[model samples]
Target: MIRPDSFVPSARLAPSADALLFIFQEGRLLLREDGTLPQGHVEDFSVDLVNPLGMLDGRPVFGARLVGEVPTGFMLRPLRGVYGTLSEDLFGLAGYAMQIVEWDRTHRFCGACATPTVRSERETSKVCPNCGLTAYPRVAPVVMVLVTRGEGRDRELLLARGPHFAPGMYSALAGFVEPSETLEHACHREVREEVGVEITGLRYRFSQPWPFPHSLMIAFTAEYAGGDLALQPEEIEDAGWYRVGSLPTLPPPFSIARRLIETVAQGE
Candidate 1:
């Protein structure tokens, strides 16, 4: 429901009334001592660096990097921890800001010529001074699939837990889309590699912007065709089919994995 009218990015620092200041340090977002976004005069924070993100509704938004000691009334918060605590619009904007800041920080130098790069005047990119190589923010696409089998009372969903997931929490199979591979191909390959199963009727569901480090998650619902569970030792900790009556812990509500499961569970 939180939709921005348009995105107009700028490299210059311009503060306005409706401008949002996204200050980050060591990969954590800075918030007020009362756990709220800083909304007053921008000069109070003593920001050292600022990058204009875009315009939302009609106001400019900026991303800042804090250099000095933490401000008197500000605190650092982990980006993931602020997901459900912040409004959807604000959270989405924060994700965008983080990605932009990271891209700027990492691409300060050119990869090919080993020379310092400068920001592009006309776009959100870094141009090499010597080689003229342009580097844009990287967005990795990942595929997620919720596999189901049977119908009526016997219906079951296949869920798997990655090694990094919280204890007892399981979600759909997912993998990064390999270069030169189609999304559908990535979907089929992930299912086979993770759980050793072949999926049929791969139907596209939806996509979500996941900013753990810039991942666009594309979800799907696939019918379980054949093969047994042969979990990938390195990636998958456990996997199984669960009936509606008995399901394990799931990912957070803000995540697309939970939505994909809920949509099929509710017969939507």
Candidate 2:
């Protein structure tokens, strides 16, 4: 249960440290002539960069979609890549930077006071000019759970596939934690709303820092309470209790949801 903040800082060279930085007009990161440096030397640049986002070896790469004029001969691709692949550290920092910059760019106009917000410059934050309000990187909290019964039980953890997802793909129940509600409360509420089930014996599992525009996923394990299983319309396209012996297609391995499910299945 090592928390992200628990990691002690060391004399580490961060990816963005003395590294070239670029913001694509199309939201992608621009690559240098050698595809090594993101753009130019950390400071001065010359030629115009292309829109970020394009595929390399068929893998989705982002940093595309510039905010201003689009560059010619620029490619477009997805923003995810396998860990340890080409410049993992660089991509990681780039992703975080992209999310922050994008959020700042879109939220420049303060929703609270409708005032123009200026960049903080001190760190990752924005401040409103008129209201004098400061806004930081927003990380939405989401709770995902692994529901289990005793060992050798004929029961299966609940799984569901949204209509928008690929066919036969199932994922754990999840929902955003509302203001004034605890993390456990959000877990129970999501399970109840999505599968018409009650959960008890709550316990913390693990967590992952998902930077899909910032989401802190808190994992938990809960016992299922007896209830009529019913799927909420629109929210869930299909759902059922698939026995652990023959579980359905699960989420990708990179997801904490899949890890939670796997841990429980192993009788942990």
In order, the Cα lDDT scores of the candidates are 0.85, 0.63
Best by lDDT: 1
Worst 10 residues of 1 by lDDT: 1-10
Q: How close to the true structure is residue 190 of candidate 1, measured as C-alpha lDDT? A: 94
* lDDT over C-alpha atoms for residue 250 of model 2: 87
Writing each residue's lDDT as its tens digit, candidate 1 over 77-151 gives 998788777778888788888888888888889999889998887888989989999999998999999999989
Candidate 1: where are CA atoms >4 Å away?
1-3, 6-13, 40-49
| Tens-digit per-residue lDDT, 1-268, candidate 2 | 1122222212222323343454543444554433443543332333232222222332223232354433454433334532333354455555555665567667768878998887664555678989888887688899987766545657588788887877788878888899999997888889898888898999998887676657888999898877877998877898877777788888766678888888877777
The most accurate candidate by TM-score is: 1
For candidate 2, what is the lDDT? 0.63
